[model samples]
Target: MQYFIILTFFLYGLVFGSFFNVVGLRVPTKSLFNPKRSYCDTCERTLTWKELIPVWSFAVQKGRCRGCRQSISPLYPVMELTTGLLFAFTYYLTGFSPELMLGLLLISLIIPVTVSDIVYSRIPNRLLLFFSPFFILYRILYPLSPFYDSFIGAGFAFLLVLLIILLSKGGMGVGDLKYYTLFGFIFGFSHFLLLFFLSTLYGALAGGILMKMKKAGRKTKIPFGPYIGLAALTVFYFGEVIISWYLNLFL
Candidate 1:
């Protein structure tokens, strides 16, 4: 029965992932509802129902658009598969608890933001605004250990990021400031601090690798939103385990 429920979540996740792809790609451009149908970005041809079956369609089409025969971006299938796995894993971890709702919400927010950041090097304010109310409502309903930690965390993150922006002078953007502050509210102070560290660590590591491969120069701008999303997901899933492991090392 457990496995069956996990499978159901995975299937539903794949479908939602498909929608998320659309939302991520369109929201940044403000064309979300203009066309009203999924169209091939390369060819601008409307995709038929058979062409929209999540990961299956990508595999059947051999990663090429039938209309233009252009190779597809591969983001579609990857996001769908990732969402499915994440949904299943979240279910396995939290079962049917309220935490499961939080987990699902986190995944939904992270996936679309990651998609937008990867594609456009921009995180739409609209996307963040859309999810902010939900997160606020969740925190209100199930306040953290001191409750005020949420507000404190958010304020701390805002000030920290603001300091960074001031000192570095173009090192980060307003989008990042908002993103980090929102996550601070979601994860509270200690965990939000962890999220910040992990995100910077990830961004640094990725930048190093890209430079080593000569894929990017020092001046090349790499989007930081994906790293932030990854760190948020990590903190959501394993922050407690990680914090405990660290504390035990000192003891």
Candidate 2:
């Protein structure tokens, strides 16, 4: 019965992931509700039920549009699978607790923002605005250990990122500033600090590898939101463990 519930979550996640892909691709353009149905970008043909079965559809079509025969972006199936696995894992970890809701909500916020960032190099403000109230309400109902940490973390994240933006002069964008600030509020002070460190570390390593491969130059503008999302998810799942281990080493 436990495994069955996890499987159900995974299935729902796949469906939501597909919608998230649509939301990510459309929300940035302000056309989220225009067509009111999924359509092929290449041929602009409305997709049928069979053509919109999340990851299964992509697999069945061999990653090509049925109408235009155009090769589809792999992002679709990948995000769907990622959401599914994360949903299942979150349920496995938290069962029916309130943390499960937080976990699922976090993934929902992360996936679309990631898709938008990867494709448009932009994180839509509307997306952040939409989720902010939910997070606020969540923290109010289930406050952090040190409830004041939310305020401190938000303040620190704002000032630090703002300073970096000013000093680097376009090194980072405003979207990242907002994103980090929200995450700070979500994770609180101590964990937020670790999240920042891990995000930068991930970005640096990826940038180095891309440069080494001659794929990206020194000035290449790799979107940082995805790294931030990845770091946030990591911190969500394992921040306590990592923090404990590091403190033990120092002790």
Scored by lDDT, model 1 comes in at 0.93
Best by TM-score: 2
> What TM-score would candidate 2 get against the native?
0.98
What's model 2's lDDT at 146? 84
Q: Which stretches of candidate 2 lie over 4 Å from their true place?
A: none
- Tens digits of per-residue lDDT, candidate 1, 1-251, equal 98999999999999999988888888998778795688888888999999999999999999999899999878999999999999999999998998999999998998898899899988889989999999999999999999999999999999999999999888789989999999999999999999999999999999999999999999998999999999998999999999999999998
Q: How big is the positional error of residue 105 in model 2, measured in Å on the Cα after superposition?
A: 0.9
Flag regions of model 1 displaced more than 4 Å.
none
Clashing pairs in 1: none
At residue 218, what lDDT does model 1 achieve?
99
Score each candidate by Cα lDDT.
Answer: 0.93, 0.94
lDDT of 2 by residue, 69-88 (tens): 99999999999999999999
lDDT of 2 at 44: 84
